[model samples]
Target chain A: MPMNPSLLDNPKSDRIRRVADLANAKARRRSGRVLVEGPQSVREAVAHVPDAVSDLYVLSESEGADTEERSPTLAAIVDRAEQCDSIYIHRASEAVMHRISPNAQGIAAVVDMGALTSEESQVAWSDTPTIAAFWQVRDPGNAGAVIRAADAAGCDAVIFVDDCVDRFNPKVVRSTAGSLFHIPVLTMGADEMLAWCSAHGIAVVAADIYGTPGNAPRTLPDMLADRVAVGQSKAVLFGNEARGLPRQLLERVDRIVTIPIYGKAESLNLATSAAVMLFSLAMSSHMGRM
Target chain B: MPMNPSLLDNPKSDRIRRVADLANAKARRRSGRVLVEGPQSVREAVAHVPDAVSDLYVLSESEGADTEERSPTLAAIVDRAEQCDSIYIHRASEAVMHRISPNAQGIAAVVDMGALTSEESQVAWSDTPTIAAFWQVRDPGNAGAVIRAADAAGCDAVIFVDDCVDRFNPKVVRSTAGSLFHIPVLTMGADEMLAWCSAHGIAVVAADIYGTPGNAPRTLPDMLADRVAVGQSKAVLFGNEARGLPRQLLERVDRIVTIPIYGKAESLNLATSAAVMLFSLAMSSHMGRM
Candidate 1:
């Protein structure tokens, strides 16, 4: 890929405006493009899915100084993007870069939304794989954090069930801290997700502080102690930020497990709960193998 | 105590301005008070340390309506404050409440700063205590989230070692989700923190991905399997958001433990790392006892 000779100095240009508009859901859907802001996210997009990245915009040397004083961190990302034949590298003025995305440290990327979406068939589940699923996770930051947590736990894939934040939202991409490209994230309806898990021979475990009246919640440690179950393939499902899993959903899952709060904290937030639950299961499963 | 008869309709009143200014560190020091925003935090403050809460501000039920229609959640919190003789309940218009604190969900509180500080001597350490300490944690939200995590793990006390965000910051208090009232949070210099933990016969474990050269970090699961050692009293210290613990600090700690990342997510954020580390240790210790 060759770098564009012309410097993009106009922040109001239609090209730049369209790229900035990708931050909006309507713009993303209309253009079939998603903005990946910041060096971390852009770097990951280029490294893991270079074909998906259409353009890379980075802050250029001020006006016309002979010396290139770009920070090494961002320069490395741009260098990596340059290696991809499909990526078009463009230099933009600081103002233009800011207009593109204020959160972008020095670089941003425009990725194809179609290429980013992972079909259910694309997910290659490992033997005894663990999956992380969220139901109606409204907060963009929470959605991103859980994705990163799932990735760190080595989950086979992430499923955003029912009405949830769009995975391509710029804020969600920024919050994932580059983990978005490391794993497959799929969207599915509640019934479809449960049915898919059942068909894949994966047990559905609902993470809720309170289980249905008759089916009392099991403590995380109690579940962990049951090594046979903990080591099996399962999908740990989390609920919305304000309201936890509904009774109907709770009753349908194979098990309801809660992270025991030793102190007086009423409950854990969705992101924290997801990390604890996923990591605990991952560590226990790996340890069981050892 | 009865509710104040006159509804505070003035958002610009000196009283309201002073309370709102408590969001600033200098203002908090000058007024010798801290602002506890949101119904959850205010309720916890009233229930746990009523004597410290001097005033409670709640949204009024409109100008002159015969039927009071305040939210039940807010009304319940107000009722709890009413039982405390020292807490003065005052009704304010929505504008006044917004001016006091936009994040306050229909209620906020003014509490004495002196009462919130936990002297090292005041912390009631358990036989096998686990302390969560952070060094140079700059973000208010991360500071608050970690405190909540520490509380959920039933930590004996929280220590802010060296430079860190003020625990009294309104953003930090809001992020805690009321855990601030449930746990004792004490600030100390790095050296003082280490010395205090040593004096209390607690092991100093630094949570760092990279330990000092030749002193590789132990994985959390590996440490957990050592039931006897994990069951003993310890202080798990975390580092700044951007930087992990300094080599000098990492070298000084009795053990350097890192949470294993099974996938390509790179590293977990400070808040997530703290929750997983604290909760894992807490669970392991409890399971050991069982």
Candidate 2:
């Protein structure tokens, strides 16, 4: 049986304060939980990793709408959440819900970060895996967008190398648009990422405009022309937004590729470049020279 | 000879006020001017459309930095502007430059909008021209990014069909990263666009996920497989961010193509979708097959 639909009317209670505090890194660290806001993210969390979710707070219609029950969309999400016997559902007043998350479109969830972290999971390898890795990506929006692109490109996993934004950051999670739950996102140092890819027989392809002096970069179309290279198990690594990849890291990668600019525009931004390069390679590999 | 390096330090002067007012559509319409901000955009204006630029305002170092002269980057831009002969250069206080545009990374310019509009220019048809068109694209950032993507894809032109965001909006211009100067961007009514494309013997390929009831969309890879279709002169029409194309518009197009999603991502955002679709078709067309 589901819990009673008792409304959480207090905006300043200790529980409310703690839930709201999860937005900060320090608070999240102390509690070992992350906040997922909005209907789309919450629905994704409930659908993909219900075991990770501990509580769900939904807005009450009395405080936010004209009807007595929640909006049809939110009601539908609540109905789905109720199927998970592990999830504790509570209806929150408008003030309480706002305090929890300003972006919550009438629903939010508190999930175990430990459940989402890849540290505790076994590293399984497919026969020919395609991975997406980023080095020193700082912006949350860019980070999230790249992750979504990686997911769309059918990458097996996403690795955040070096000093990158936290995947659990609210802005990052929100920008991902439910992709945070779609794929495995791992964080590691540059050396560790290289070692892991090497161990897994995955070639590291650096996506940079100007490669190191000793190793010039090939255009993406040129790279795609090599059917053997396109079929290899590989990890495509992108660089930071501004500084790009360091020389040391560039020299370490097995191959370097560049996307050609056909017009007067200088270059594509990191997110757009990743999408084009990843999707192009994926399409070429799947279609087999068509 | 270049104009004297006069300092326009007053942030509240009427001249400063008028330059800043170009941010608003009403002000730009009245004065026939548009504001260009940042090093990338200002430099592009001076390089590509020097005749349209009337004045350049650069932040004086004392206002925000240590040196009295302009920074090396800004100094180079100023040097480029000096070659134009008609452009009046001014050194502005940080406050004045900030008032002109908060996004200006130390420089801004006032260019004649009449010079940028495509109305006065002749539209010539290329043998197999590729056009990018959008209907009701409301976001400035999305509009700019799409223009940049279209430029990067070697598109012949961009057409804003029906009601859409102004290309000259400061945010849109800044987001283009100088692609605004790279290609001719025109605006027209839906009927006019259809008529123009028909006259030019260009196919209208709608980039949409769903086709009308009678017309099911074909996958992008399937579309790419047809060499004749890939080599044809066409316009790829993207719809609004949320609503997508209306049924009437979708039915009128020659073909409807969709980008296949390989992962759990619900859908790609406007900019990423545009980049992937535009670049894939471009690469395929130029290279024959994968």
Candidate 3:
């Protein structure tokens, strides 16, 4: 799509307000649209999911020049968006861009929400897939951080089990950096997640400090030492931040593994635990092949 | 010390203002005190370093009943503070407590800065100790998260090398979630850090994705495979949030190791990288002992 010649100068315009409204859950659900803010997110959306992006907004130098003096980073993102014939590009003033989203660092994208949601049937699992699943993760930042961790660990997919913060929330999207576009993220009930894993021969390992009575949690090192078991296809389920996994959920999982704390700190936070556990398993699995 | 009989209802009183001023770096320097906010940090200070706490401020239920209906958690922290006869406990109104520090959840403490700073001479190194160090880490939250990660991984101590964020910053203290009191944290120049590691017969390892010319970085798993070398006393030094360690510093390290990115995400953030690397090394070292 060619760039829109007219610059978006009015911050109060209907188009700008509509773009900003996507930040709200109700607005997003009503319009089936989500705002992807910052250069990193916009660039990834354009590169990987170009067809999903309906509009690309870039900060212009002035009312006259739409493509002049942009930071190399922003210019590159805009250029990438131009290659996608489906993406409509618009140059906006600083105030207009700020109004669309305060976090947009010279660029933001309006994407179709339906295009980002992944179903179980759509997922292409590896021969021995590793999945990262979360239960009732409420914080946007924590949710995003874990997704990035999962992606970095090369997890095949992410499943948000039960109640979770909206994955499309701007803060969550911003926190994921660009990993949100790199991996498939699905939202499903806990039972469905467990059943899907079982059907696919993937074991469900719950990440918790305390296991149910009589089922003491295995230390991560102990789990890693079992190379064959660690290398097997699996889904790691993490609990909420304040309240960990419920006993019912723990009883249903195949196993419980906890990160051992060597010092006096009470426990690791959700995000840190997910990263440590996921990366540890990834490293162990990769090393097993060698 | 008995609790102060009178309630501190005035938010603008000199004593309250002085307590609040500890949040400012300049004020902290002049007074030699730091503000430890939230129940976790205050509780940890009282439990681990009681003598360092000069004053403990807690929110009161009302002007009449100083201690009635306080949350069990806050009441427990207050009880711990009371056992230390040197700690002066004061009850403040909700407005006064909020005025002191917005992040303080029912409790805050005024601690002597001198008590928290660990000099090179004072650190008691463990047998084959592991240390976590950062060079020019600028973010307050990142500094605190890394400190917590180091503590959790059983690092002997943490050294903030070169220019870094003030560890006493309330955000840093709060982000540690009480690990600030669990580990010894020191700030020093890069040369001093390197010299101290050399004097102690400890190897220095730099955590960077890209190593200098002619010296490619080793993957973390490969380093982990070398059990004998990894089990030795070593200090793992991380770089700044944006600009990684300079080539000069990277060249001085015994080894440069990078966490492998199995997926397309660019790289892990400072906190996540620290947790993964520190925990991986810790797990490897612990398993080696077994």
Candidate 4:
């Protein structure tokens, strides 16, 4: 483990302090940056929004183990860096990298704040675009898990609405299992999502556990039928696990979609529900193809 | 809080010590019961599989202060517990209950091992009751979440095969958010699942990250397409985040399903992926109705 001469000589630790506080929402938002620690998370940070990367630091050991060439994942980061010019692989010691992104896999990447995609792009749901949106979700882990689920379910994009956790939060990156990169995740106004849906002629389906009285809900299956028929894309929005979606959103959507609850526990986690609904939409489309 | 005179007068303090150890699997299996805590959880225990609930206890103060009478969510439990049954509901203290179940919600229900449902009532790929089998998933949270998702997806049953976490584990029950009653979960050997699938005409679709070569999928959508074919009901199996499905089982599956990975991470949590695949399969059957 080699230490950078500049830091060793100066005895300055402002950089380390800032990175330590990166876990909090306020610091993350204010810095216009988010920190990625660990080889796995750093690799994903690189893949998802390389352009958002403002600075890159590689622990001397991570650059290449003493005996080998650069690791493939690391090399991929270097390759992706060409787009944004913020990539750096240097001889900072493992200890130093850990100081910046502690518990990181001996590697760290400083990403710019624009990691979230523009919500407008997501609203233009192509006939085949699978999109998922989350609202008022409190848990960063759940939010991250859902993003990974959306990417897995083949949702074209995902959007986050009010009170959801910060997307770039380290916990979120970890939970995504790296699917955060492939899909565009836009954090924007609810009205923006509504407008985008209107423009694209896509339906805004709110997934609610409780349906309006006396009206039989076309199950998520029924909701997907419209998408399958026109070959239009669909977006499903999920709310907080505890309170569920606001009644306003529930009523506003094309229709309420619910996964049946048969057991004593009536609901699933926010992220899990998102996965279920998104998968339903995706499968419905594929079934149409068949 | 109130205490049962027989339990409190306790020459049986040793008994409490032994039961507390049931948090460990070996103790639970040997005892043929799992220790459960929490008011809502206990309620769920009573509501579903009441006979499986071998013992019941409550702090007297918990009776009125617990809001069970007021919380509609607790109604099912009260209704399920026959009035004549000798459930010890004590009103004197909450502290004692905490000793029994940490963070106990005023009540506790001890449950027997999970039961197995027959193939005739399961989800099979052909003209049979279709069910999904989750195999050797390590996380109790993931297991619980999957059960909730399976319930939502309308899978007839959910089975836990091989040596996975216990279904009734407290963490699992908490993760389920109350759907434990809706789905019938069976635990059996890998060979048992294979035999069940063969007999029921169910096509087993195994979700694997690396069933094919070269491309490491970054998102589930990439591989999930195979899980959603029309005209077939399927039982899907998923493994943990670090380890995927067992190779022997993966090889034996009729079709391999994958949720394509688009991000930098290698995979999603088992529950998220299960939800994606299960919902996809359910919607495939239901979309035509829509």
**How well is each residue in B1-290 modelled by candidate 4, as lDDT tens digits?**
12243323232356555655667778877877676676656766665556666666554433434343334433445445544264443322445555566755656666666431234354333353457687777788788778878876667788888898877677787566555655677877999888877876777767776774432332333333343344465577776557777666676777675775432345667777777666655555554343
Residue A34, candidate 2: C-alpha displacement in angstroms: 1.4
What order do you get sorting by TM-score, best first?
A: 1, 3, 2, 4
Model 1 clash pairs?
none
Candidate whose DockQ is highest: 2
Ranked candidates, highest DockQ first: 2, 3, 1, 4
What residue runs in model 1 are displaced by over 4 Å at the alpha carbon? Answer: none
**DockQ of candidate 2 compared with the true complex:** 0.77
Q: Which of candidates 1 and 2 reaches a greater lDDT? A: 1
- Flag the better candidate by TM-score, 2 or 3: 3
**With candidate 2 superimposed using the best TM-score fit, by how many Å does residue B244's alpha carbon deviate from the native?**
1.3
TM-score of chain B of 4: 0.75
lDDT score for residue A71 of model 2: 69
Q: For each candidate, what TM-score against the reference?
A: 0.98, 0.95, 0.98, 0.77
Q: Which stretches of candidate 2 lie over 4 Å from their true place?
A: A1-6, A63-70, A120-126, B1-6, B63-69, B120-125
lDDT score, candidate 1, position A161: 95
TM-score of chain A of each: 0.97, 0.95, 0.97, 0.79
TM-score, cand. 3 vs. native:
0.98
- Mind giving the per-residue lDDT tens digits that candidate 1 earns over B155-270? 99999999999999999998998888888999999899989989989999999988888678899999988877688899999999998788888878998899999988989999
